[model samples]
Target: MNEWERLRHAMRATERPDAVLDLATVMREGRRLRTRRRVAGAGAATLAAGIAAVVVLVAVDASGSGGTAPTERPPPVAVAPPSVGVSPTSPEPTPPPTVARDVPPPKALGQVIDSGVRYGTDQRVYYLVRVSVPGAPKVTVGLAAGRRSPNGYLTTDLLVNDVEGADRSAGFHQIGYDERSSTTPVPTFGYFVGPAQRIIGTVDGQQVDARLARWSFDKNVVIFWFDPAELAPGKRLDGIIARDASGRRL
Candidate 1:
């Protein structure tokens, strides 16, 4: 056989006898395959761009230089640790000293309750008298001083005026018997309406006894006095207190 026939024979042997070749169908399949390849390439390019964009964003975030400004975070707060052990308690407050309630027997106005000679003076005499104040609802007491003449005649002068609103219901009422002067030493005196057995006075941080007197007419009214000697210079009368038979302060 010639070379061309041999070549024809080889082609015929490679071709399937049962298969029918359709040129239109082959063209349609080739076009579809090419379209698929184009689509795949475009997808790969788009994915590469997206990956590049993500890499740039990561670099910017790590550098902390660009993109939307990072949200501002508030500073951390400081908290104190809990305390341990027992809590201290406050001390109780001391109550103010008060006097007992006692009513005195009623007396006529300007009536003398007690009388005594003034300390450090012979001619001067002091007297405690019950008196009534104008426009006041309760009766009050007063202290008066007088000088005695040789003929037994007496001239009187009111030393401390009666304090309005002072009565037997009060804890106690006090007045200075005489003013402190070069010639006369000041004596402190007062009266209380109670069953107090004794009167207490404070001088220079020490407790001292006060002379007490009770009138036969008004036994409920107790008169008390502190001598001028107890109130010397630099010594102050801090307070006055009355006590009952049981030693309880009234």
Candidate 2:
């Protein structure tokens, strides 16, 4: 009993008065602590989001500055080369030269039929002859005049006619004729198809004789010429007549 009583007295001596609790103050302090905890959690979430954004920005800057980005290149172009052995400003090619051809001289066929000298002029002479050519079907008859120079060279002028369709049966078939009225004494001459013995020419109502000759190769072909001095001034030969060997008109 004593031990129990002593233990009880010690307890009573150490014990104080009973504590009084304030409900309203305790509730307000509890609410304020809960609010502070919520605010601190929200602030920590915002700080984590800001740190993630900064890391993403650093990664993008590193890729661009370090030259690791992909880029596209343009396509290649075509070009033409210059031509060989040619120039833009060069001249055109030249053509070949032309060549000249040679010509042949005229050839005679028969002997001279008639020849005569001008009156009082020995340096000038006239003649009649015939020539043969390669392409002609018949012989060509020619009347020619020649003049001699002081150097003993002779230059000739010739007038010719073709005798392809002469009428030998007629009294006269004229071959060719020429008159030189510009001379001091007008000269007239002609050749014909004939077998005649004489030829007469009339001028100014007077009869004049014409010298007649036959070709050595054919007697049917004849030539006649008149003395130019016998013609009166300003008058021409008006008519011509021929006679056969029997003195008959031909």
lDDT tens digits, residue span 1-250, model 2:
5998788666645544234589899999999998997787667666666676576578768773321322234698332111111111212221111111121222333333323444344344334444443443333445444333445444443344444432222344332233332232323545556666666666655666656655545556666656556544234456666666666666
Model 2 / residue 76 / CA error / Å = 99
Error of 2 at 149 (Å): 7.4
90: Cα error in model 2, Å: 84
Please state the error at residue 15 of candidate 2 in Å: 99
lDDT of 2: 0.46
Can you write out model 1's per-residue Cα lDDT over 60-130, one digit (the tens) per residue?
Answer: 87884433322234598432121121222222222122111111322223333223444233454445555
Q: Provide the TM-score for each candidate, comma-separated.
A: 0.45, 0.41
Worst 10 residues of 2 by lDDT: 94-103
lDDT of each: 0.51, 0.46
RMSD of each: 52.3, 65.5
Candidate 2's TM-score reads: 0.41
